[model samples]
Target: MSVQSESVTDTGPEQTVGYTLHGNRYLNITNRCTLRCAFCPRFNDEWTVQEYPLRLRRDPSFEEIVLAVGNPEEYQEIVFCGLGEPTLRLYTLLEVATRLRPHARRIRINTDGLANFVYGRDVTPDMEGLIDALSISLNAQNAEIYNRHCRPKLPGSYEAMLDFVKVAREFVPDITLTAIDGLSGVNIPACKKIAQELGVKFRRRVLDVVG
Candidate 1:
């Protein structure tokens, strides 16, 4: 079936409510990810949140994403966020962000910070100037605990994530690294310290478990 057809027929109360493309346009770049975090519902559960379903049988192309955004001027921030990492689609993201930059006041990216490792190239440089704010998931302080919690697909991803943040800080004006409050083996204090070291803001968001 076509994407639009699937989107229309799949409509339900939950799908409509949560996934409604608010003025803050959120672009889900890819379904592929390098990490399967323990606390992330996306890891195992069906990709649905609130009334919006996160399920993606296929990844959308750049033209498709631009069309999805429709009028870029309507949104305050065109955010790159999804059930998966936006950096996985670095070229597409850059193209989309570049297209939206002139229209939207801000372009933000919510990422897992393993883009370099996943793509085997420095992804930070690509985001330069295009991204206004960078929100990365730095879920743990130490490597061992980080691996256990985030379950990154690539080796050295924990360090790679941290390094990405440090490099990203050089270009992106607002860089925030976040962690969930209640995850086991997470050292909030240490994570905060790491954020400080990287010269980025630190945030701890509460993880909500849906039935």
Candidate 2:
């Protein structure tokens, strides 16, 4: 369904259980991104994932997030996920997540793994107790392929991204590093090796193409 067609201002809750969608509430922090991955749909205004449209407006305020999650106890997880990197608004996200924590069964943050450069500080340490699960995008095995595919805006961003994952594992026990299949010359074995080094779980997701 289209986000415009749906009630974008809907603050009502949809309760569910056991890893279900539970009508996930996503916040589009900023459309501007540091990475322009070859497979990224940042330029596409009509992107959709699992029926949740990725069309985004300007960055939202803490109050907007509070209102968006009128009642958080309804969803299985209050996720910080959207078309852009959530950590770009590190302070705002932490505020929102902390407020929703009391009501949410779980809190998760899906990121592109470049928070350090974006925020100019080590962002993971601040999220220790605030976030439940941290899912990061590790789309390539080596720096060469990673740079080619991810097109990160910062220098040494590939290495920095890996470092972010390593550091996050120290605080967040449930850290998962994921990659999109068939894009970055990423092999399962290599990804598993990287995850093993970082002491985190690795997953390969099927890339969805919109017609």
CA RMSD of each candidate after superposition: 4.7, 4.8
- Residues 1-211, candidate 2, lDDT per residue (tens digit)? 5334332443233211111243655555555567887777655544555555455555667786677666777666677766667787888889988888777877888888899877778888898888988888887888888888888888899899998887888777788888777774777678778988888888877775210
Which digits, one per residue and each the tens of the lDDT, describe model 1 over residues 55-138? Answer: 676677777777767776766777787767778888888998898888888888889888878777777877778999988988
Angstrom error of the Cα, residue 74, model 1: value is 2.0
TM-score for every candidate vs. truth?
Answer: 0.86, 0.84
Q: Best by TM-score, which number?
A: 1
lDDT, candidates in the order shown: 0.74, 0.71
